[model samples]
Target: MQLDSGAVAEGRVTRVTDFGAFIQFDNGETGLVHISQIAHSFVRNIHDHVHEGDTVDVKVLGRDERGRLDLSIKELLEEPEEIPRPRAIGRQSPQFEAKLRSFMRDAKERTTAGGKKPTTPTKRKK
Candidate 1:
């Protein structure tokens, strides 16, 4: 059977390596599923996901520069929902605003004064 980009196929994991796993279809076509393509989340170890002789469904991402088929198991799995980031401090709380105002007032007072702006302490010669 001819496989094209984006085609989904079931294959057996023939070998596992540090970087990826090799899968062989029934028709004798073999492809590689890279570690990054094995899951939606970070994959620290490819062995944790697939082992030799395991059957997995993978999508054909495309061919590599070497003309080997590049596959992805992540494409067949549902993507994880994005987690919302925390709101910025200035926008989130009145306490933060009050602190910012106090800091700015202090800075303005220090600057308007005849004293020079605060400077880092100098090192003394031994």
Candidate 2:
């Protein structure tokens, strides 16, 4: 089958290079998938996403001036699902609540004993 421009099909990753991967289709037509086109996100290392002999669905981005097919793995694949990031349980340190609880207890005890405000240690700088 002729690998026409704008066609999307499954291909096998014949080889991977620092720049891109060479995808050889079932019809023996080969194309290069540029690193930027490999994924929607930044691809620091191509091996992190694709390896040799791996099957990938690719989109034909048409031929260059020399007639070599330009392919994009990102275009053919479904958009990656956005993963939820970890959010802070509260707006303070993990031990903040514990420290505040202890301070409150100490203040209450001090008030009952002498009705005086709790004094915090002060740093002396020369």
lDDT, candidate 2, 19-126, per-residue tens: 999999888789999998987777879999999999998989999998888999888767768833556576788598789989999988977767766677999999
Query: What is the Cα-based TM-score of model 1?
Result: 0.64
Reference-based TM-score of each model: 0.64, 0.61
RMSD of each: 7.4, 11.1
Name the best candidate (by lDDT). Answer: 1
Model 2 regions lying over 4 Å from their true place: 80-126
Question: Candidate 1: what lDDT?
Answer: 0.90
Writing each residue's lDDT as its tens digit, candidate 1 over 38-97 gives: 988778788899999999999999998888999999989888797335455556588888
Model 1 Cα displacement at 41 (Å)?
0.7
RMSD of 2: 11.1
